[model samples]
Target chain A: MADAPAAERAATGRAAAAPSRPRRLGRRILGGAGRVAAALPAALVLLFLAAPMAVLAISSLNATASLAFPPSSLSLRWYAEVLGSQEWAVSLRLSGLLVLLVVATTAALGTLAAYAVARGDFPGRRAVAGFALSPLMVPEIIIALSLLYYFQGLGLVNTIAGLWLAHSVVALPFVVRTVMVSAQNLDPTLERAAASLGAGRLRVFWTVTLPLLRPGILAGAVFAAVTSLGEVAVTALVSGANTTTVPVRIFSAVQFELDPSVAAISTLLMLASVLVMVVVDRFTHLSEAL
Target chain B: MTSPDPLRPAPAPAAGPAAHVVIEELAAGYEGTRVLDVPELTIRRGEFLSILGPSGCGKTTLLNALAGFVRPSRGRISVDGADVTDVPPHRRGLGLVFQNYALFPHLTVAGNVAYGLKVRRVERAERRERVAEALRLVGLEGYADRRPRQLSGGQQQRVAVARALATRPAVLLLDEPLSNLDAKLRREMRVELRELQQRLGITMVFVTHDQEEALSLSDRIAVLNGGRVEQLDTPERVYRAPASRFVAEFVGAANILDGVADGGGVLRIGDTVLRTGLPGPERGRPAVLALRPERVRLHTAAAEPASADAGSGGAASGVLGYRAFVGDAWHSEVHLAGGATLSARTHAEPPPLGSEVTARWSAEDVIDLTTAPAEEAR
Candidate 1:
C-alpha cells in the first residue's frame, strides 16, 4: 500500500511535469478507461435485477393472453381483470391480513427477544438466542415441511392461525436481527438514569426504552411485512383453500396455467412493499437499524 | 499493614461517622471479580465527599451500590437512618447523575427535570414548580422548552444535575458527571456542582478519576484503589501526607525513592541523608520516601560537597537531563546516580539540559510510606 501511493504520486508528478499534449490526453483516456472498468460489473448487476421487473411489467401489458417477452402490444386489460377477479382479490386480502398479523406479532416478539439477547444475562442465553433465530439459519424447506406436519397433526393446516404462526416464525428472525442491532446500541446509562430518576421498571421500559426503540421497531415491522407478503413455500404448504394467501395462490395458479394477472398482482405486491418502506423511512432513517 | 500512628494527627473531616448515609460491610462483585468491599463509609448530611480513583477501582461500583443500582453480596446501606439494602433503585430515593448526563432526548429541558416528580405522581402544579425551581438552581431557567440535544455539553450536564436534584433526595450520587465535558466546562461545572450541593444543603457523593477535581471541590475525599478505600481524609491532608504509597503516587506527581531509616531524625536515600519528623521504621529497615515534585527545587550547582544541609533538609547532586518551561511553571527532569530519575517543578527559569544541579526538598514534605501496605492497582 505504501509503494502504491508513492508510485501514484510519481506518476502524477511525471504527468504534471510533462509538457506534451498527447501524453496528457493518453493519461486522461486511461483514467476514463479504468473508471469504466470498475463500474462495469455494478452496471451489469443493476441491469440483471431490473430486467426481470421490466419483463414482468411489459408482459402484464400484453394485449394478447400469453406470457411472452417484449409484449406485442400495450394494454391495461390484465390490470383491470386482476383487480376485478374474485380469487385474486380474496387472495390479496388474505395476504394483506396475514402480513399485518405477522408484522405485529413479530415486532412485539422480536423486540422482547432482542432485549433479552442484547442486554439480559441468564443461563443458556446463547441457546435461547439460537433457538429464536433457528429459522434464519436452517433451510426454509425443512422449516416448511416440519411446520406443515405439525399443523396437520393439530388439524389446523388450512387455518388462518396456523398460517399466521408459520409466517410469524419465518419472519421472526429478521425482526429480531434488526431490533437486536438497535437494542445493543441503546446505552445502558439511559436506563440507569431513568431508574435513578424514580421511574419504575415497567415505567422505564414503557416511557424510556420503548421510545428509543422506535426506529428499530419500524425497521423490523417493514422487514416482517415485506417478508410475510412475499413468502411462498411455507404459505403454500400450510395455507388451506379457505385461507389461501396471494403467494400461495400464485404458486398453485402457475401449475395449471400462466395468468398475466399474476404479473399484475406481483407488481401490486411490490408496490405495497415500497409504499410501506416509504412510510417507515419517513419516521426513521432505515439505514440506522442496519 | 497500617502505618505507625499517623505523625501529625492526620487531618480528616471534622464530622465523624454520624452521617445521613451509612454503608456497612458492603461487598459486591460481578462475574467472579470482586469490585467493591467497603467495611464502612459515612457521609455527613450536606457534605461533598468525592470517591477518587483510577478506572475499575470500584469507585463507580461504590456509588452504584449506594444508589441501589448494584446489589451487594453482603452488606447493609442506610440512608437517613433507614436500611435500604433490599430496596429497589426508584424506591431507595437516592438520585444518580450519570457520566453521559443521559437526559432523555425525547423530552424538553423542563420535561426531563420533571420526570422524577411525574413518576412519583406529584400534582401538576407542584411538578411545574419543582421543575422550574430545579432549572433555576442550575441556572437554566430560560432553557425549559429547549430539547437536550439542542443544548451544549455544559448545559446538558446542568440539566442532568437539575433532573437529579428535582426529586429532593437525601443524597445525590454523581458518577463522573463532568468527564464528558471539555476541560473548561469541567472546571466550570465543578464550581457549579459544589455551589449547588452547598446551596441545597443536600449531601453529595461524587465518583471521579480526576484528582484535581476531587481536591478542589470535595470537603472530604475517599481515595480508592483496587476496590478499597486507601484513605478518607481532607483533600489538603491527603495531598500533604498521603497515608500510603498508592495515594501519594496517584493523587499528584510524586518522586518515590528507596531509603533506609536511621535510628535518628533522618532517612537515607542512596548517598544522601534527609531530615524527617515522621516516626519511621527501625534502624536499617527498608523504607520508601515520597517527595512531591513541586517541593523539589533545582539549582545549577558546581563542586558540591558530598553531604551538606540544603534548603529545609539536604540536597542530592544530579544532572538535569531535559528542561522545559510549561506555561505555569518550569519543569526539569533530573538524572541521578542510581539510574533513577526525579522530576522537579520550579517557578524560576529552568537550568539548561545536561547541567549539573542539586534537587532539594524539605524534610516535612517527605512522606513515609514504608509501613503502608501496597494495594494491588489496576
Candidate 2:
C-alpha cells in the first residue's frame, strides 16, 4: 500500500512532465521555424509562376515599336494589328480546323484503345497496349524526323494531311493515357449488371460505359486540341509552303526578325492555351486526370 | 417407388410447374482449372432458391453460369424446357442485381429503370408508365429524377431492383446483394427483398456465403462445396437432418464424438454407452455421432445423485473448462476424462471453471453416422 502511492506519484509526475516538454519545444522550434520552412518554398513557387504571366500581360499593351519591360505608353495597337492581318486570320482558321480534327480523331481512337487495354481480355493485350502508347517514350525530335522521312518517301510531303496525321500521332498517346487511367478505375461489375438487365452489348456501351467515361473523354479532347493547336516540332517537318499553322508561322517570323509581332502572337497562343485549360478545369477535374 | 397416378387430380398446384431450370452435367473452369462440376440441379418456378457456401466453394461460379457469364465446357443449361447453352447473357432475358448495386451513375433513377424497355423498343409513353410503375413497386416513385450518387446505399439498391424488374425477365439473379450494408441495414434489406420476391412471384436465385442469410431468406438452400451441391433440400431438413458429416458441420455447429458399435444397437464412447435411437452398424464397427450444443443439458451435481447407477439416464461426467456469456445464453466447454471436449449452450449461468459437472442429453438428439472410421470422421 505504501509502494502504490509512490508508484502512482511517479506515474503522475511522468505524465505531467511528458506533455509539457513536447509542447514547449514545439512552440519554440516547430511552431515558429517549421511554419517558415513550409511557407517559403510555396511562396517562391507561386511567384515564379505568376511573375512571367504578369510581365507578359503588361508588355502586350506596350505602344512602343519594340518589346520592352515597363513600357512608356499603353495601347491595343498590337492586338488590332494581329486581328487585322489576313495571314493571321488564315492561319487561325487552319489551326481551328486542325484542333477540331485532332480532338475528334484522338478522342475516338484513344477511348477505343483505352477500353480495350483496360477492360478487354485477349492475347497480347499488354504488348498491344504498350505498343500503342510507345510514342510518348520517344523524343519529339526523333518522331518528327522519322515522320518527315516516311512522308517524303510516300510522296505525301508538305501536305495538310501529313501534318494532321503527324499531330494526331503525337496527340493520341496523351488522350489514351488519360482515358485509360479513368477506364481502369471504373468498376467492371457495372458492365455485367448492364448485360443482366437485358441490355445488349451496344446498348451497354452507349448507356452505361460511355456516361462513366465522359470526364475522361472531355479531358483527353482538351489536351489533344491544345497540343495540336500549339504543336511546332512535328508541324515543322510536314508543313508545306501553302499550309502554315500559327506555330509554324510564328517560328518562321521569330527566325527572320526580333519584333513585337512575335511576342504579340506568342501572347495570343498563351492566352488560348490558358483558355482551353480553364475550360477543361471547369468540366473535368484536372487533378483526377493527372 | 410407385409413381402417382397421372389421372388423379394433383395436390398443391402440381408442385408449382415442375422445376423450370435444369442444369445437367455442367463442368466449367477458369484458365484450365475446373471450378464447378455440378452434375444436376433443378429449380422449380417462382421459387426463392439460395446457393449457400463459403468463399472459394464455387457458389458464385454456379450463379455466373446461370447468368450466362461462364460457358460450361460440357453441359446443357435449360430454362422452361429450352436449351440456353449457346445463348449470350443479354439474349437469355435474365435480370441480375450485383453485390455493389451497380446502378448507372449518369442516368436518373427513372432512366435506369427504363433502359431495358427502351432497348426492346417500347413506346415512349409506355416506357414512362412502366418505369413509374417499377419505381413505385420498390417505393421510390418520387426519386425518379435523382441520380444514383444522390441516393443512399439502400435507395440505390432498391433502384437496382426496380431496374431489373422493369424488364420482366424469366429469372432474377442476386449475387450477395445485401453484403455491402451495415448489419442492421442488411437485415432490413433481406426482409424487403424476400417480401418483394414473394409478391412478384418471380423465379429468383440468390447466392450467399452467410449461413444465417441463406437459412432466413431461402425456401430451399443448395449447400455447395468443392463446386458440387452437397445437399439440396428445405432449410429445416438441411439443418436438422444433414445427409453427410460435411453438411452437419457446415450448416450448424456440431460436436462429433467417436464411438464403436456393439452389434446390439448400442454404441460406446470410452466407458459411456449411448442408446442411439437409430440402428447401430455391425459389431466392432467405428461410427461418429453429431450432437448440437443446445440439446445438451448441464447439471452441477454428479448424475443427479440418484441415477448414477442407471445406464439409461443419458448422463456423462466432465470438468467445466470455460464459460462465456453469449447474450441470452451461457456457452460452456466441458472436458471429459479422456481429453475430449464438449460444448453445451445453457440458459442458466454456467458453473465456474475447474468444477465437476455432468452433461446430459436425450438419446433422440444424437445423430449417428457410420460412413467413415473414427479417426477419419471429419
Candidate 3:
C-alpha cells in the first residue's frame, strides 16, 4: 500500500518524459496508415448513402415524362411542371404549414417533458420518461391504425387539425429524445446559483434553464420539422383530400402514375432538407446539438 | 481596495451582533439516516464563519440548512429574529458561491451580475450601476462583456463572486469555493476573499474540508465531526486549546498519548512515565492526552537535562528514526523505548538520523482530552 503512489508517479513520469526515436517514427507512419484505413470505410458509407439520391436527381431531368436512368436526353421540363402545377403546389404548402405547427407543438411539449424527466425525482419519473419516447419504440403502423380509428370517431379525420395532430405524435418522440439529452447535460448548479441570487423558480427557468437548453431545444425542433415533413403512414390514414401533405400525395401518385415528375419532386424535397440543415448549422452549430 | 457603498444597513443593533443567524435543534438527514444534529449554533453578524470537517461529516448539510437548500426535519432557523425555515431558497436572500463557479455560460459577465436585479424588477439604470460596481469590486470591471467560457478558471471564479455579491444578499454562503483552484491561486484567493468579506461587512458562511483554509480565514470555526460540532471557537482557541481529540488531531499535527494517570501530576505510558502540568486523575484511571508536534523540543542525548518544569525526560530518550525538511522546519521522528513514536517540529537542526535524542516539552502545553465525549457513529 505504501509503494502505490511511488509506483504510479514513476509510471506517469516514464510515459510523459520520453519516447524512443524509432518508436516515434513508427507511430507517425502508423498514424498516416490508420487515417487512410479509417477514411476508406467512411468514404464507402457516404457513397452508398448518396448513390440513390444522385440517380434520382439525374432521372428528374429526363425530357420524356418516363422515369429513366442515364437518360438519352435531359431537360428541366419535369422540374418546371412539378413547380407550376396547382395541386402539387397546394400539397407542398399544406406540408410546410403542418411541419411548422408540429415543430412548435413538439418543441414546447418536448422541452417541458424533458426537463421534468431529467430533473424531477418524483415517483415513476423513469416510467414517465419511457412513455415520452414510446412512440419510437412502437411500430408506426400500429400508431397509424389507432389514430385512424380514434380520429374517425371524433370527426377529426379529413381535417387539417387531424393531420397536424397525427404529425405531432410522429415528431414528438424525436424532439423529446433530443431535448432530454440536452436537459441531462445541463448543470444543475447554474439553476441553484440563479435561485441563490434572488431569482424565483419561474425566473430561473426563463433566464437560466431555458437559455442554456437552447441548443438541445433547437436541434429537437429541427428533428421535429424533418420528421413531420416526411410523415406518411399516419398522415395517409388520417388526412383527407384537402388535408393531403406532399409526402402523402407523392405516395398516392407513385402507386398510380410513374413519371419523371415524382423524381423531380423527390429531388426538391431532398434539396429542401439539405437547405434547412445548412441554415440550422449556420445558426446553432448543429454538430454540438447532436 | 476601495470600499464600495454599504450593500444593506448593518443588522439592527437591538438584536445584538451575536444572533445574526441562529439554528435551534437542527437535525437533517437523507432517507431516515441522520447526517447532522445541532442543538444550537449562532453565527455573528459580519463575521466569516467556516464549517470545517472531513467529507460526509455533515458540514455541507449544515451549510445547506443555512442556505435553505436542505430542509431540516426539525429546526428553527432565523436571521435577525425572523423565522426563515419555511422559506424557499430564492426567498432566503442568501448568496451562494459554488465550488465550480456555476456561471451562466450564455450570459456576459454584466448580464450574469444583473440577473438578480432584473428578477427583482430593479430599474435598468440602477441595475447597470450595481453590475459595474460588482465587477469593479472583484477586479473585473473591463471584462464585463466577456462570456464566462471566454475567461480563465480564476477569472470565472471572480465572476461568480461578483454575480453573487451583486444581489447584496444578507449572508453569503460559500461551499468549498476555493477547493477547485490550483494551490498558488487558492492561497491568493483566500487572502482576497478575506479582504472582500471584511470590506463589505457581509456575514459569510464558508464550508470546506481544508483545515488550513478554515484556520487562516475564519474569525470563528465550527469544527464538525461525525455529524456533530466537536468544537466552536476562535481559530487560536480551536488550534491551541482543542476541546476534543478529533479537533486536536484534525486541526493540526498532534502526538496522541494514551496512558494511565498516576494521581501524582504524571502519566504512565508502558514502563515510561511523563510529568503533566494538569492535575492527574485518580490513580489507575486511563487517560488520553494530546501534545502538538511543534511543542515538543529535541535535545542531544549527551547534553545535560533541562530544568524539571520544562518536563525534562530522563527515560524518554529514543533513536531518531527519520528526519524530513518541511520547507520551514525540520520534522524528526523519534522511536521511543516503549515502542511509541514521538514527532517533533523545530527550526534548529537536530541530530542525524539513527542517533539517540531526548524529546521534551513543558507540562503546561499538554492538552488533556480524557474527558472529551467519545465520537458517535451514525
Candidate 4:
C-alpha cells in the first residue's frame, strides 16, 4: 500500500513513453464495438415497443380528417369524441365493471387455490396446481373458440355474466401464479404455532395466514385487473351487443374504420395501467411479490 | 433472575404428582413409512420428560403425537384420566414452542403472548395482566411493545416460551427451541427453562437431539432409536446405567470393548477379567463392556501395579497410540497388546506416543451394554 503511488506513477510514465495514440484509438474502438453491439438489439426492441404508443398519442391529438401521427394541427377533438360517444361511453363502463368483477373473483378463488397447492399435503396437489395454471399457457384463440362452443351449448353466450366469467378465466392464472409465489414463501410453522396457541382453523387462517398473504393479494389484484381490462378474444366470443366491452368495441371499430378515438382510448388505457402499476409497486413491492 | 416468577403465588392445580399421562400402542407414519411406534409410555405430572434422539429418530414425531398435532394410527393418549387421542391440538390444551420460535411477525411481544387468551375470549383485563406476568416470568417485563424481530435471539426465544406459557396449559411441548441460539445463549436459556419448569411444577415434554441439554434439563430422558424407545430412565440412571448399547453410545462418549462373560458378574477380555456390578450373560458369551472415557485412568508403565490383579479389572498394560489436550481433559487412545484400542480421558497429559501405560476403570463405573432384540413393531 505504501508503494501504491510509486507504482501508479511508474505505470503512468511508461504509458506516456509508449505509442499512446494508436493504443487509445484501438481501446476506444473495442469498447465502443461491444457497447454498439449490445445496444443495437435493445434499441431496436425499445423502438418497436414505443413506436405504436407514440403513434397512438400523437394521432389521438390530431385535428385532421384522418388518424395520422405528427398531425398538421393538434387538438383534443378525438378525446372529446371518444368520451362523448354513447357507444364508447357504454363500452368503457362495461369494461370497467367487468374488470372489477374479474379482479375480485380471481383474487379470491386464485388465492384459495394457491393456498391449497402451497400448503396442502393431499394427493394430486401438484396436478391441481398444474391444471390451475394451464389456462395461462394455452393459446387465447383455442380458449376463445372452446368457450364459444361451451357457452353456446350452455345457452350462456352473449351474456354479461358470461363475459365476466371469461375474463376471470383468462386472468385467473396470473393471480394464482403471483399469489402462489408469496404463499410458498410463508413458513408453515407459523400456522402450527397459531394452532398451538389455541386458535382454531378459521381463526388461524384469518389472523395468521391472511395477514401474511396481504402483499401477494395486492399484487395479484393489480395484475388481474390489468389483464382483464386488456383481454379481447374471450370477450369477443362471449359478449353480446348489450354487453360489449371497450376492447371488443375497439376491435370491431378497427376492422371497419381507422378512428382517432381508438388512439385516444388506447392512450387512456395505457395511462390507467401505468397508474395501477405504480400504486401496486408503492404498497406491496410488486417486484418482490412476483 | 433466579427468583421464581411473581405471577404464580400458589400451585392452583394440586402441584404433587396428580395426573398421569398414559400412551398405549401409539404408532404414526407419513406416506405409509412408519416414523414412530411406542408400545406404552407414561409421563408423570410435575416432571420434565425429554424425548432425546438424533434427527429422524421419531422424537419430534412422538412429541407431535402427544400434542395432538399428529394422530396416532392405533393408540390411546389420555391426560388426567381423560382420553384426548381424538382431540385436535387446540382442544388438547397442550402448548408447543416451534424450533424457529414462529412468533407472529405482525404482532408485538404483548400481542403474541395475548394470543391464546384472545382466542379463548378471556377478559381483556385478565389477558393484559397475564401477558405482563408471562413477560415478567421470562424476564422481559418492558418488552411488550417490541416486535419479535427487534429482540435478540435469546429474548425472542423467551417470548416464544412466554407465549406458550401464557395459557398455563397442562403440559408444554418444546421442539428444539434452543437450537437457534448461539452456544452461550443456549446454555443460559437451558438454565432458565429448567428453573421455570421447576418453579411452575408443570409437566413438560421436551424433544431435542442435544444429549447435554437432555442430561442437564430433564427429570427423565427417553433415548429413542428407529421408531422405538431404547431406554427410559432418570438422567443419572440413564447416564450411569444405560440399558442398551445405543443409550450408552448416544448419551455419551463411550469405549465399547468386546469381552467374554465369565459368569458370576464378570467379563473376561484379552487376559483381563473385569468385575461388574450387573450379572454377566451366558458363560463365555461374547459381551461388550461400555466404559466412560473419563472413568478410565491412564498410568505410566513404571507406575503400574503388580501384574496378578491386572486382569481383575484393576489394570491392563498398553502402548499409548495418541494424545490430545482438549482444554479440560486429555483424551488418549491406548492400544492394548491384544490389538484392541481403548480411549482414556485424564486430567493430565498422557505418556509419550508408543510408551507403555495401563488403562483402568472401577468395575462399577463400567456398564454392561446388552442390546435387547428390538421389537419389529413396524
In the order shown, the candidates' DockQ scores are 0.70, 0.74, 0.74, 0.71
Clashing pairs in 1: none
lDDT of 4 by residue, A153-175 (tens): 98879887888888888899988
Kindly list the per-residue Cα lDDT of model 1 for residues A124-161, writing each as its tens digit. Answer: 88888888888999888899999999998998798889
Q: What stretches of model 1 exceed 4 Å from their correct place?
A: A1-33, B1-18, B31-33, B141-147, B262-266, B270-283, B302-312, B338-340, B374-378
User: lDDT at A92 for candidate 2?
Assistant: 86
Instruction: Provide TM-scores for the models.
Output: 0.90, 0.90, 0.91, 0.86
Sort the predicted structures by TM-score, highest score first.
3, 2, 1, 4
lDDT of 4 by residue, B66-131 (tens): 888888888889888889999898788888998999999989999999999999899999999999
At residue B41, what lDDT does model 2 achieve? 87
Error of 4 at B266 (Å): 8.2
Cα misplacement distance, residue A192 of candidate 4 (Å): 1.5
Q: Top lDDT: which candidate number?
A: 3
**What does each candidate score in C-alpha RMSD?**
4.1, 5.1, 6.0, 6.1
Off by over 4 Å in 3: A1-34, B1-17, B270-279, B304-315
Question: What TM-score does chain A reach in every model?
Answer: 0.91, 0.87, 0.88, 0.85
What's the ranking of the predictions by DockQ, best on top? 3, 2, 4, 1
